[model samples]
Target: MLPSDPAAVELVTCGKIEIEGRLVDASNATLFCGISAEGVDAKCVYKPVSGERALWDFPDGTLAGREVASYLLSEAAGLHLVPPTVYRDGPFGPGMVQLWVDTKDGDDLVDVVAPRDVPAGWRRVLRAMDRFGDPAVLTHSDHPDVCLLAALDIVLNNADRKGGHVLHGTDGRVYGVDHGICLHAEPKLRTVLWGWVGERLPDEAVEALRTLRTAVRGPLGSALAEHLTRAELRALQRRLTDLLADPVFPTPSADWRAIPWPAF
Candidate 1:
């Protein structure tokens, strides 16, 4: 089981580590696997600020903090989609560290996106071309976990929600990761999980948002204040209020691209 207290997880992440290797698939950011000395003995992902590539849109050295912020929001909102993450000084300077999730089958959303035949019970959102110009059908499960992820992405203003970031755990839970580009002050939400666009928000999701609305004014807000700029915090609050008021899935914005490049 994952550690329940955020402080405990932070301690584990900040302790000494033995670098396992680098994860090359993490484009624009360097990711490392390491074994911690905090006694958890679990493998963790270490993303150092110095290794992050400068992006024209996002400020440099802030991606690591954004990763931690996403975890904080997920915890406060009771979404439990993002894995536990902490920001601390690592071997390579300050960075974010998170426990690596052990997926059940190593399966990702990419599998369902272009299956030979559509999976039974899955909802197809749209028909599109894959990166190779081949035909593909974008889809997602009608499961509650998927819905919660969609709602969380909206609040986060996630600019990248690629299919590879979605994971299925052995515990029968769904997880979303790679949140370094989220929570921008600007309206930069981009995602592939739009299967429920324009649909009414589920009761569970609305209640979660209500809980988040309260947490943001209390402990959650204070914690995030250290990581995000004031303007970004205000934007998050505005998004929460808007979500609570309307409680409907949003459609793609005409002004901005709605999906990330190489959708998977």
Candidate 2:
């Protein structure tokens, strides 16, 4: 599961899933599962649609499909930022199952640090005072992979890109997880990755966007329509077009809260 290769998909899709435990901190029922297939085994997270909580903006029982859609979009763009995810039947019914990505301990891509102690290559996001009235700043690494994730969040219209959702994989890749509130028609892009606002996107991200533009027009668009509405699909196309025309990280919008509360 750590490497999350193409075989992981087959394992997650056809493997027998055993509920190992539950991730208690998740808002919904997120099960830690052990999957076995033809003598192969791996770990994954299973989120049953029946456990999804209703949201005022997002429809009920749609979060699981949205998670799968996010993974598909990431793969279509050649971003590979999201771990292999699939929507299939589980013990509790249909839901999203994603490969478990093992992280590198003590390695964090985003953090809230003392203003004076901000790392040399990190980018400052917000300057504010902590609960103790001590000065601090929200910061994230300036690594190219981190920057690419920021762009991916923009396209996803991801409403919950919490710092904890960004993982430093042991495979030396930056992975983003927990994308249930994405692919909405509205412009609700809240995230902690606002460090690169107003800057030009990395060359690789631009190429990814170009590839996505074509993919979204053909088979990808048809596939996503099964999970998303027509309006949402149109909005996705427009967002892609806009980004390709002007490839820059956008600043926070005033219409919505730009940062998710309890960011970590």
Q: Give a tens-digit lDDT track for model 1, residues 139-214.
A: 7677778888989999999999988888777667788889999999999988888888899999988998999999
Give model 1's TM-score versus the native structure.
0.91
Itemize residue pairs with steric clashes in candidate 1: none
* Model 1: ten consecutive residues of lowest lDDT: 1-10
lDDT for model 1, on a 0 to 1 scale? 0.82
Q: How many Å off is the CA of 75 in candidate 2?
A: 0.6
Best by lDDT: 2
Model 2 agreement with the true structure over 145-193: per-residue lDDT tens digits: 8999999999999999999999999889999999999989999999999
